[model samples]
Target chain A: MKDRKPLYLMTPALAWLTAFMVIPCLLILALAFFRRGLYGGIEYTFTLENLALVFDPLYAGIFLKSAAIAGLSALIAVIIGYAAAFAIAAAPSRRQPILLFFAVLPFWSNYLVRTYAWIVLLNREGLITGLARWLGYDAEMPRLLYTEGAVVVGLVYNYLPFVILACYAPLSRLNPEIAEASRDLGASSWTTFRRVVLPMTVPGIATGFVFVFVLSIGNFVTPALLGGGQFQMIGNLIYAQFLTANDWPFGAALSMVLIAIMMGLLTLQTFATERASGAKREES
Target chain B: MASLANPRLMLAILAAVFAFLYVPISVLVALSFNDGGLPTAWTGFSTRWYGELLHNRDIMSAAFNTLVVAVVSTVLATILGSLLAIGVEIRRRKGRFLETIIFAPMIIPDIVLAIALLSFFSLLNVTMGLHTVILSHVVFNLAFVCSVVRARLKTFDWSIVEASTDLGASTPVTLVRIVLPVMLPAVIAGALLAFTLSVDEFIIAFFTAGAGRDSITLPMQIFAMIRFGVTPEINALATIVMAVSVIALTLSQRLNRGGLPGQ
Candidate 1:
């Protein structure tokens, strides 16, 4: 017992991850280089055609659309989430925890349910339409469900809590005196906020933005439910390719691209954070 | 102050944001209790829909399968993750590669992982069912559980275990009696979190479920039902599912203290 290493204890869990996650992920990489079989399985011969097809105009259009939706969702979520976080940070100190807790409480609930809630709200015979009809406005409103806008709203709803949590960390930790100091030095309120407040919270903003974008761009459920399958995002395309289309090789290639984009953004975020904080680590 | 000087503005932002966050959920919850069970009007309130859940065989079986997955996965994850957390903290080396392997499960897109596992299992010619879903779930669940337990271990008193060993206790005994007690809260919190995640999980389970009715979990059932369209029954089902997760998470949060699950 005395001679036993603690590293031995890590073996089982780490081994499980390596087998299930690591191996599977590597398999996906291997899968991308292979050709699709006539019977819709992987062929033994290797080729770069699948990877190249990811940039084919049709798929690239979906990627561009996904990026646009993801970007818009992230942007909107950040603005709203930042304001909510700021409001939470400004409340009486005793109530801040409660506000923050409730702010994120919905996030902990089922993601599907949250998405379904929007379905109920936006459906033709749904709550909003019903309310509108009851309020004497029945002139054939444009259908809301199954649109790109609905997809964006659902994406924003699902990820807003994460942004709130992300932004709240920096906002809560911000020192009050800095703002007052800038104000005392004759900086206007807006100027003080723009110069003194927002810059310091860049890491949080970056984190929130990256998270929303990454999750949204690859999201299948929200678009499937809210977009009513009217539009295809990268996620739906991947789903179709793998499950419906039986093009596993192509799906794997698309995933490789998705993973590349995710890793690149994360690496950039890490660099940004380090650059932002590198100046303050004089002693270290 | 890290606050808005304009109280009116703060109030307005908080009100609007909270409304935006909560209104849809509130509508769903309200409809679940509607006696008329239509979005058109609030006829009255009743628990009939809740009662109706008992008679639905598909949902009942799906719920049972979900419970099996969540319970089994949580137990395995808790044991393996606690050990992993303890082992990592006790070791001197901070291997970045090891860190990435552990954290990748947490950060990977659920769809990518789902497809990856689907491909892996198919390539291996393994039978896909509830068992495979359990296996796939442990990949992420253990990572989350490891993270939670590891956070507690950061402030852990290592000397007690050393003292226990010096006082003639074996390593296993010291861990069981001393370390486990200190880590019990985090371990439980981790288990609760894992349970909710597994219960609510859909995509991976859907892929691994292998086109079978028996292995269908709650979320997969919900997905199928949702694709067909929304009904009052779904609203009731959604309400119950949401409540279960919210309660589990709230309890987990209480046990962990101050730190939310993801953070």
Candidate 2:
């Protein structure tokens, strides 16, 4: 009877998730296998053409490009974020929370507003140009806004705090004794960090990398607003299929591929985490 | 070890990272007050653009729509999510599938969820409006609220509930008189977080809101204005929106950490 109580309590939320989240996701998956109607609607005929088109050279090129951009952004963010997290963790313990709090505060702000801030900074007559003119470089200002670099900067700026938080978790939790023992055994600080500290924190690095990569790859807004209309990432392709071209099947297929990539990364992250913890267990 | 690295280097790195995080935002806020409405040059400081925002009907309607969506969705999400959290924590046997379902809304790309909900509603022949936005927001909002509440529940003492039950209190009575009061702070924190998220969320609201001016949210309005170009009015609007989110999230974080030792 007591066990049944939990089931009863869970029913409402489960029902809600099933109706809204689960069923809708399943609907999209099913939609991917159907044909597009002549008039911008879905037809009830089964077809694999939509899935096949996702692997076509043109679309596949976009996928590879998106991955490259996402990977680059993740790599840069992880480097910067890891350094910030390490610095925070090394700070006086009393100051760590306060520092971490402010670090992540910007992340809580409106995403669009944060992204739009870049526009104000990078636009033709924006702050960067104003500064350039102030320095007496009176030639035509270089185009900074609506470029690939702008998109990469926007992704890094938006996702950096998350990476910092992820990295900080393992860094702060690290046992100091192991590093001390490494030093006592004549190992240099760099060697200690590489052999002991970095090994234990692989999970954090993996988590941050996977997170930034996943979100960046699937991002539409950053590319749309910052990369301009010409830069076609997978997200923009999906957006075009749904809202512009009215090709729902193709859009669904693209999203499925996106989901596949996300699942793969996330599974790898979980595996990395488990392995790291297993290594820790062996150490203790 | 600490002596090996220069303290100046650490401080410099910290300063540089903070500058990278904050400089653009500070520039936008400062320009919102610029008398010259263009970013080309700052003539002086003025609040004229803020006054202009007050007179814009499109922005006004979008703001109103956003409030409605945020408030309604936050309430529904708080109720559903708190219950779900309590239930899950009590069961203590959550399967991998269940955990994935709960976590999915947090990590799923907003565009995918937006389109999925858009497709779902349209196929059901349901009219899209602010109501659809509210419904869709609840899906993600509830997940966030659940996670927050569940985190709080981790440190909760189950013995109190047993004590209340032993004294002949009914389930509802025990829940209301015992559990709810203990969980109130976290619940409020979760609600605030949900409210802030719903207010700022754009893509999902955009796709699910259908084609209508009546349902346009503040973020959507901001997006449209941004696409055209940056304006001082957008700066004012952005400042206000960012302030609200920062304030709400700060309050939420404080409340979540309240009564915890050394926080």
Candidate 3:
């Protein structure tokens, strides 16, 4: 078998990754420990001030808010997705793949476009407004496009397909006999679901939750567009710092914190997935 | 499980979920053809927005840049990614470290990677432009391409390679004459996926495209248009972008029967 030559062949991918991924990530890590320049460039002097600024009440508040909003979106998406996946799984096996494909099809499209779709629906002059007025309500309409609720809705809609995809896998792979056995053992449907099905699918739920949360937290577009200028998620803040504010050092610092949070959550998710899988193995 | 057999609830849920997913997209697509300036009003059907898109120089240039970036990045990513996948799959000794590092690009947050690449380029005095966007995009694009190709490789039969080798074919000759033909479909599928990602990618391009309208890509143009307030032009642009993605991914999935990446 080819050996050394193949390893050499992998060098290009490795080199590209090292140059663009590893090195850049390290550069940001280094930037986080440095001071911001007065003119929006980096200062060579090493300091913890940038990192410290990340924890300041103002920035920390933004971080917490981003996390909360992301959490809410993830939670909502999981519930909606779980229900949908459950329904799909219940369908005849022959039709399941097509159902699953449509469920996930929209997600593969442009992310920005999907978020913009909500803008068309929720903007003051958008469809919802037109519909509301046609229904004869003359009251002052609520602002819909640029709000926290709109952001959550956008995140949920954009990510629902993925949540369905994640949740559907375990559901489809589930052995119906296990559920039937539980049913024959006299457990209620809800009880069997809670104790048997839910436990079995905990890994999927965790995966979906983590996937949604991570993407939503670092998501700049949805909040920027749907939440409008008022909403500042971590992603938006980082964007502003780098582009508008031109505070590269501080932006790098904020990005580091964002990565740290993502990594932490991802690590926790891995543990959760493994534990659930371990339990499943025990059941087997 | 029992409750799921209830057709009424199942159908309702399915309808609701599809509506939630499809409504916004349909609305956007429908609005693109609306003659009225506002999204709510559809006085007449017109292709005016698409016509307006052609006349708009800023958007046209952005579209051109997007095409250039997507094509260049996808080509480079496909080549490197296909090689990497073949190499990784062929090797008997697959290191966990190598696997994890290769997969890291797919999982990393875009914002983080964007800033990281931005800082890395600025620090290295590497001028940020379409080239930088292509380079940064290839990082993730290659990972995706590798994944798709690797999935195909998993179901690949290795005995053919041994047979070809036993017949005294050289390594390169064997790969060219044997593996290439078989893996061609997956390679094309991977290239399609990479193209789709590069086209849709915004944040990475936003950061790396440098500060000027000259280097702006379609997503950047769309972003500027949206922030400047929605216009019929944006609806048109968004429609085109989404259509491109759907077409590319549908084709990719057709070739690769497994599933789309990140699924």
Candidate 4:
């Protein structure tokens, strides 16, 4: 009771993170302000040219495109995941835990395996094509793989479990009586959902949307694997800058931008959650 | 109003979403056993790819390296993370800065952390290898472990610790003899989770494991194989990797009902 700063227990782990995670991230931040050397080394001079370049029309276009893809994936994932979560929530309460478990099981698997699963399904000679041909559809099929759509599908597929998990929380906690009361007042089912259930669940939707968007925006694997490197998302751009273009400063700068976008979305998610709880408190 | 609770409609939605989620991975798993080893058609069943996998020296070595990294990192992460969790929970001060430190790794984009670690390691001229990969893995592994342990601590009774201290037991003795035993399931659950994450981590390992094939983990190997295209070996490998994670996560879930970070 007397000791105020008894941090002995946390010191080791915090020190490790500070050294490895915090210091490294800070190094990258500082590196963004420096110049890239002729031999791809980082030079010891400060400059904002790299940060300025992040908004260069060329780079900014990639940012916008990445956002679009990420936004689309997040949208689709939230829709489908919300539906799934709602279905699970409507099930018998005793079965809800197991249902949620099965829904989220796929998320635990390796990320690359999950992405490669899309590759198997969407390849030109893959299962979908085989099924199409078997169905006697003798028309030129649109390319199924290596497209932006494929990248979005990959992103959605990979992150959908997370959305389902997020949405299920609020849906499960929802007091059925509220919906009953809304309907008792002659509110249509859709009207009740739109005005009552949906409003209560906005925080979950916000979290799910932000999670998928933040992950998808900087995703290198899905685009690389499914987009065939043609749709150079911000992720692949960062990859090339560091590994191939040998520009450490630019890569650092690009990641800084990515971090900023992530932080902004996360802040919004936090705000939504806090506001939601605040409103709930007023209701009580 | 009946539509909202319509069992048939709810079942259909669940079926479609689950199919959408599972069908792709299921196909990959099914194809791994195809005797013909062709993406186009399934022949008879065989374990030929798994057998071939055993003989692939690079994959064998990569698996060995992955195991080494996973085990070592999980041990470090569990010990440090459990201690960190206890430390954070026991203290009266609930600092936002400390919470952010614990939370950042779980949400930070993988590539950002990977590149940051790469830059840091190279700046210090640390020769990158499995060692460097282990170092980076602990950064996130400990965070995940901490979060999981901290979740179990939410329901923990603090009065017991004060009581134990009042009975003349030292702080470390009370923690070791009292708190650790109570949260042992969570600690183990967190360790299994950390092991799975370290085993499956790829992007970070790919960057930090510089200048040699010697440091390649299983996921890095799988990524390289995947980029080459659809091959029987990759399907088989993906099946094994998926199975490992699924099994580990299930155990973790059983050990701590609310083990997952968000849950």
Tens digits of lDDT, candidate 1, B98-189: 89998999999999999999999888899899999999999999999999999998987688778998899988899898888888889999
What local lDDT score does residue B200 receive in model 1, on the 0 to 100 scale? Answer: 93
Off by over 4 Å in 1: A1-4, A280-284, B2-4, B258-263
Candidate 2 lDDT over residue span A4-46, tens digit each: 5767666777787888888888999999999999999889999
Query: A1-284 in candidate 4: lDDT tens per residue?
Result: 23453588899999999999999999999999999898988789999999999999999999999999999999999999999999999988888888888899999999999999988888888889888999998898889899999999999999999999999888888889899999889998888999999999999999999999999999998899999887799999999998899999999999999999999999999999999989999999
Residue B1 local lDDT, model 2: 28
Quote the positional error of residue A169 for candidate 2 in Å.
1.4
TM-score of chain B for predicted candidate 2: 0.96
DockQ comparison, 3 vs 4, better candidate: 3
lDDT of 3 at A276: 80
Candidate 3 has which clashing residue pairs, if any? Answer: none
- CAPRI grade of model 3: medium
TM-score each candidate.
Answer: 0.97, 0.97, 0.96, 0.96
Summed over model 3, clashes come to: 0
Every candidate's DockQ is 0.72, 0.64, 0.68, 0.67
A99 Cα displacement, candidate 2 (Å):
1.2
Displacement of residue B166 (Cα, Å) in model 1 is: 1.7
Q: What is the per-residue lDDT of model 4 for residues B210-251, given as tens digits with 9 covering 90 to 100?
A: 979898999999998888889898999999999999999999
